[model samples]
Target chain A: MSKQFDNVSVVAKANVYFDGAVTSRTVLFADGSKKTLGIMMPGEYEFGTDSKEIMEIQSGELRVLLPGETEWKEIVGEGEFTVPANSKFKLEVRKVTDYICSYLP
Target chain B: MSKQFDNVSVVAKANVYFDGAVTSRTVLFADGSKKTLGIMMPGEYEFGTDSKEIMEIQSGELRVLLPGETEWKEIVGEGEFTVPANSKFKLEVRKVTDYICSYLP
Candidate 1:
């Protein structure tokens, strides 16, 4: 579904990682909360977080192995999963995937 | 550079396009303006728009043929370009490119 935002100011610079396997941009609003909007291509990735992160899958699919979990979980477009603070997680990408990371204090 | 938003809400659903070549998510704020965060992979693509669009290149590179321009221009990470309303443009992607489209009223 299409979404609407009241107002948003995008940061001028972008974040690039892993030889273009991942890229992200930061969006700033009038308030204080922050988020990173990014995309991931087909690859295996491990991510560590300082704070709790809400990983919202915007498109494609991800097979995730959360911290301490033996089974890999599938997350499709429009689906979301959360990682605990100071935790690490792994993702096995089968296809191109888009995502948004909302950090919680 | 990383970005910060005061308060923002992400629309649950994601926008997927072109067989995973592109995908995006909508973000909503308390006010009303809207934005689509997305990424594009390596390929040639043509895009048409109704409203004026500010395409920000977050990562990788893009060779663009703007409306009426016979020569292609390169826009790299942290670069941007504008497309007029009721216009079309072509992009020759040499690498994975991430972008954000801000639609202007």
Candidate 2:
């Protein structure tokens, strides 16, 4: 379900699942989008640059890799960080993880 | 986090917890609100009539009690239903449950 706002739109409800390895669809917004992303495990996954503009892991363990960066940055679990638009990132899921992400428009 | 829209507003992210028996704040919107509510257990909850205008359970188990009603209606897990504004509802959680509730404005 979706709700429209003056400057933002919310996908009110969604049930997303990822197996051992799965690539999510590249979510794009007019300018950006905001969402609550939850990883049900602690493991690793890669996020492409074409993904959302901004990503914030509200809760869970995640490792992020910026565009042109070779090493993964621990963003959650151990610490937290923000990812800029057009930047490539990856997440290392160590266990069942759940987080919230928002893409700015 | 919140984002503004032309006709609606979005509470982008929230982490709500129900400790077996707890009553949530009566969420009120200007005209309405949209939210995804999850019950992390299979039990029951009583939603007062002063709650949001509309509620939709996207997943998991839920039992609803309408205002002035003496019985509860199962809305999820086994079936699904919608709650109108100013209506009183209750949820019966039977197990570890998680469901999304959208409040429409």
Candidate 3:
């Protein structure tokens, strides 16, 4: 993938969650799709998604429990996971994580 | 200020600092100017600058001690500060702060 998103609009403010432990900036594409580039500090967080979210982890270590999954999935360095819409997932972020979340339409 | 930056390029990777206590996304303008949108968690941090920087705090509270200054400048809600090139500054972040930092040419 390209290292940079070109010709896009970026919101000035951040979407903060878990008392700033998880923060993201929204990037708006010309095709009306949006993605969030986010950082996750070492912490445990549960998130509910309104849309189908494909999370691409760029770096760091973490374990994820997707909705209705029986086992926890671990990713070190770089990986990805998908979550269904209107579902919740759990994350055990073992290190500082950089991720890009694309909300699929 | 405009709530969003249009027709800009955003690097996919984030700039992580202080073990994830500070993180930022770089936005590249068409005119070669660049800015960083960042989040600062509650903590104390000392930073040194290579070029002149204009820091606009969009939210949260913090106190800053600029280089060659004795007084601590406090900003609650929203405010801004400037740091000269090759100078060092300290910040006491009392709350989670969202900031947009511009590098002056």
Report, for every candidate in turn, its global Cα lDDT versus the true structure.
0.75, 0.46, 0.97
| lDDT (tens digit, per residue) of candidate 3 on B1-105 | 559999999999999999999999999999999999999999999999988999999999999999999999999999999999999999999999999999998
lDDT of 2 by residue, B1-105 (tens): 332223334333334344322211122244665444443444556665444544444445556676667877765444555666777666676543434455654
Best candidate (score: TM-score): 3
Ranking by lDDT: 3, 1, 2
Fill in the DockQ of model 2. Answer: 0.14
Question: In angstroms, how far off is B22's CA in candidate 2?
Answer: 15
Choose 1 or 2, whichever is better by TM-score: 1
- Predicted model with the maximum lDDT: 3
The interface root-mean-square deviation of each model, in the order shown, is 4.8, 9.1, 1.5
TM-scores for all candidates? 0.70, 0.46, 0.98
- Isolated chain A: TM-score per model? 0.90, 0.53, 0.97
Off by over 4 Å in 1: A1-12, A27-32, A76-79, B1-14, B24-37, B56-59, B76-80, B98-105
- Per-residue error for B21 in candidate 1, Å, reads 2.5
Tens digit of per-residue lDDT, candidate 1, span A23-94:
676665566666777778789989899999998887767799888899989977667889999999999988
Q: What TM value does model 2 have?
A: 0.46
Candidate 3 displacement at residue B68 in angstroms: 1.0
Q: Candidates 1 and 2: which is better by lDDT?
A: 1
Candidate 3 iRMSD in angstroms: 1.5
Please write out the lDDT profile of model 3 over residues A36-102, one tens digit for every residue.
Answer: 9999999999999999999999999999999999999999999999999999999999999999999
